[model samples]
Target: MPSLVDYIIYTFIKIDDSLNKILEEYDRPLRARVFKPKLSDSEVITMELIGELFGIDSTVGIWRYFNKHWT
Candidate 1:
């Protein structure tokens, strides 16, 4: 069986190869904590999904939607 990282990497790449192309984009971005703790990738991905589905393009817009609906 694959390790957690292996599975996560495989699943992510399989789901969207463009995601891999964009992975380097976040390495230098500011990562702030929220909700008294850090949210997992699943939570972030959920917000991304909703945002993309609604044709939201900006990161700030996605965050605003998540804050409004997920609160």
Candidate 2:
């Protein structure tokens, strides 16, 4: 069946993208993996961007959570 989406898709498919050039970016280190589905450096920074996203900022509070979950 004919549709607007099909029309747009076909138009872009005929366009040439060979003229475009892109630069490479630096690779992220493995130690930055902190959450499920693990994220990149920019993503990891965003995760902690929100104030108190982890809650209870101090070291003691963090240690308490670690102790409860670890031993």
Candidate 3:
């Protein structure tokens, strides 16, 4: 059986792939005044999911956790 981390990664990949497909189908035009974000929408969403899974209640907590554990 795959490890828990491996399973989590696989799930995240599937979610990200689905999100990309949906975005491609939508094909929404970008606002003229809005600049491109450094992080992709999928990436931000993945981080949010990770935070929730780990019971992180605040954005700052999420950032701190990621900084310590992810990076």
Could you say which candidate leads in lDDT? 3
Candidate 1 local lDDT, residue 58: 85
lDDT of 2 by residue, 20-69 (tens): 12112325433544565533333323223321345757556654654575
What C-alpha lDDT does candidate 1 achieve relative to the native structure? 0.64
Q: For model 3, how does the per-residue alpha-carbon lDDT over 1-71 read when each residue is reduced to its tens digit?
A: 99867865886798789887777766573323367877666667777787888899888898788779867
Clashing residue pairs, backbone N/CA/C < 3 A, model 1: none
Task: Please list the residue runs of candidate 2 whose C-alpha ends up more than 4 Å from where it truly belongs after superposition.
Answer: 1-52
Q: Any idea what lDDT model 3 has?
A: 0.75
TM-scores of the candidates in the order shown = 0.45, 0.25, 0.70
Q: What's the ranking of the predictions by TM-score, best on top? A: 3, 1, 2
What shift in Å separates residue 23 of candidate 1 from its native position after superposition? Answer: 15
Of 1 and 3, the candidate ahead on TM-score is 3
Please give the lDDT score for candidate 2.
Answer: 0.40
Q: After superposition, how far is residue 24 of candidate 2 from its true place, in Å?
A: 22
| Clash totals in order | 0, 0, 0
Ranking by lDDT: 3, 1, 2
